[model samples]
Target: MKKYLLLTNEELKRTAKPYLIVVAVLMLLEFILTAAITKMHEGKIETFMRENGVSMQEAIDAYGKSSFAQVVASGPFLLILGAGMMVILISAFVIWYRDWFGKTNYIYRLLLLPGSRSSIYFAKLTTIVLLMFGFVAIQWLMFFVLAPLHDLLLPPELFERVSIAAVLERSGLMYLYDFYLPNFALIYLFALLLIVFIFTLVLIERSYRKGKKVIRIFLQFVILGAVYGATLLVINSDHLFANEKGMLFLAFTFLYLAFLVIIGLRTVSKKITV
Candidate 1:
């Protein structure tokens, strides 16, 4: 257990700099963006009121009030969000591939580490989860941070101010990262399944090499397909008069995760060569 923690911590340490850079860059960019967007809209309102000789309220009525939710919905803001996701997607591979393809083959050292090789696998998986969830937690809090910034730039009368909760409620991200406890668990559970699925694919590819290339690729697809196929069948089996489809789906998910983890551990321990 101590070894696992050490491995996890070591894995996290490797990516710490880049992770922090990405988080800081995104937050800074969003902060600047929030201010710029506020300034631009405020200017528009001022211009319209001056040109037409109207009151601030009248100008807002004519042009509509700006809200934090609207700012987030803009193309530029969504692009920033996409940039964060892009880093995560690249990380999914970089975390493992770099160890093999880096200046020296770090994989040799990692696999030979003094403990169950499963520790290495779990360490990498845990690092990915922690990095991802850290970004999410900070980004969630960013709404509150930006809310005041939004209100600070414009007066209450000019700004369409809403509670942080209301801002999230109106935003699309609320669907994925729900404020409600139950849905939050379900959403993150599926997210973990996705990361595990990706890890399984990478591990399987790294472990086997003797077979014909085409055949190996085909088999990889087939095995991955089985994971998804079983999952879908369970979820869609309600027409067969299953007692509780949700519970069945959740149960099958846990079983499938175990199966994949077992495969990954065996691959790491026995199949992979230094």
Candidate 2:
């Protein structure tokens, strides 16, 4: 347990301060952007509502729904891009960091210590997974926080009509849970699975003395995509009914993650240099 904590501390120290700063800055920017866009376009929004088949009263009654959907959708794409870039940046850092540590002599030094290599690998792997998960959670929370502020900027009656709670009750939460949540979870799991596989590929590539790294990575991606395509074909065929689609996908995700973890462990446990 103490060793795990130490591993956690090491991983936490890897990019904690920089990552936090970036997250804070991006969240603040998103919040202010949403609020500012709302306020700035409030008049135009009212005009659009009036131009549409709605009166001022009706516009006021349907603030976020009728007015802010376009802006909200496009504005949040930037946040999504930012979050994705962060994930890639951090994942690349982890891969490079391992090689960096090896070059710095810490690889041999740490391996010589009274600890299992599996412990070290799993600790780092767990840390990276947790960090990636935290990144996803933060991005979602940021978008969620920004979403309602547009409604908040409207008049009281407008806000009352497009209230976040009302939106949730109407169709948002249903659509989210029914349509978006499962897919998002699937994508998140896919990203985590990719990261684990990439880590294993890196370990394997590094085991070689020559220029097999790029070839190995390319082949790995090809094989991974083929596997994913085959799985999707199976899922989309007779395996899943309409009512059972979401559950099937969710189950497949859990099973896939487990498979990746087992494969990762097996690969990492084998003979490999740092």
TM-score of each: 0.87, 0.68
lDDT values of the candidates? Answer: 0.81, 0.61
TM-score of 1: 0.87
Best-fitting candidate, scored by lDDT = 1
Question: Deviation in angstroms for 154 in model 2?
Answer: 3.4
TM-score of 2: 0.68
lDDT of 1 at 22: 91
Q: How does residue 80 of candidate 1 score in lDDT?
A: 90
Report RMSD for candidate 1: 2.7
lDDT of 2: 0.61
Residue pairs that clash (backbone atoms under 3 angstroms), model 2: none
RMSD for each of the candidates? 2.7, 5.2
